[model samples]
Target: MVVLKMKTISLKVNGITKEITVEDNELLLNVLREKLGITSVKAACWRGECGLCTVLLDGIPVKSCMTLAVETDGKEVITAEGLYSDERAKKLMESFVKHGAMQCGFCTPAFVVTSHYVLTKNPEVDGEELKKELNGVICRCGTYYQIYEAVKDAEKYYKKETKS
Candidate 1:
């Protein structure tokens, strides 16, 4: 008989620390969406090509679909929902809404999380760099321009925060 080893892992999702048991070979995407009930980490292309399952692992964006649950042990993951309390993220969200960047809304969460990371890392990122940084997540509705504008609009908030 084949046996799957179950292991306990402690991971923080959306600012909440959770210690849960999972199979040794379980994927982080599954653990986050299924076990932890974090639906923002979409499951479009399970192969990680879509980047919809992206999450900030230890403050760096990574495809949860491509990561193993065991690897996330003792790691901190931040999703779009986790950034809700941040002033910059709030501005970003507002900008997205104002610019109508969330058509269809399927990829919004991932884009938000990545965009938040980019703004946090480099609030002064230019258009080309922002485009490159956001290339990982695809918006099927072709709302790229709006998304770009939204991110740019929110840049000032991050810059202000940085100066403070």
Candidate 2:
């Protein structure tokens, strides 16, 4: 008989710290979406190809579907909901709406989070690099042009942070 081990882990999500027990082999995507009820972390293409479940792990973007819940213990995981207080993220979201970057909205959160990471790292990221960086996330709605425009429009907000 095989029994899965339950492990207790503490992870900070969207600035809130949560301590929960999870099966040893549970995926971080399940932990965030199922246990924590973070619906923004969508579950699609479980193999991590879709990037719909991307989350920031200690300020770096990672595919939660490919990450183990246990590995997030004591780490900070930021989803779209968590970026509310961030000016850059806020601007990016606004731009997304204004530019009509999302359609159907399933992949919006992941694009926002990943785009936030890209802009945070380099507000002046060029078109090719931006495309390469966002290649992981797939949008079936084919709003790539609009998404690009939104990110570009929000570049000023991200740049403002660097100057300050």
Please write out the lDDT profile of model 1 over residues 54-158, one tens digit for every residue.
Answer: 999999999999999999999999998899988889889999999999768999999999999999999999899999999999899999999999999999999
Write down the lDDT of every candidate, Cα atoms only: 0.92, 0.93
Tell me the tens digit of each residue's lDDT in model 2 across 94-120.
Answer: 999999998899999999999999999
Candidate with top lDDT is 2
Candidate 1, poorest ten consecutive residues by summed lDDT: 1-10
Question: Per-candidate RMSD vs. true structure?
Answer: 1.1, 1.0
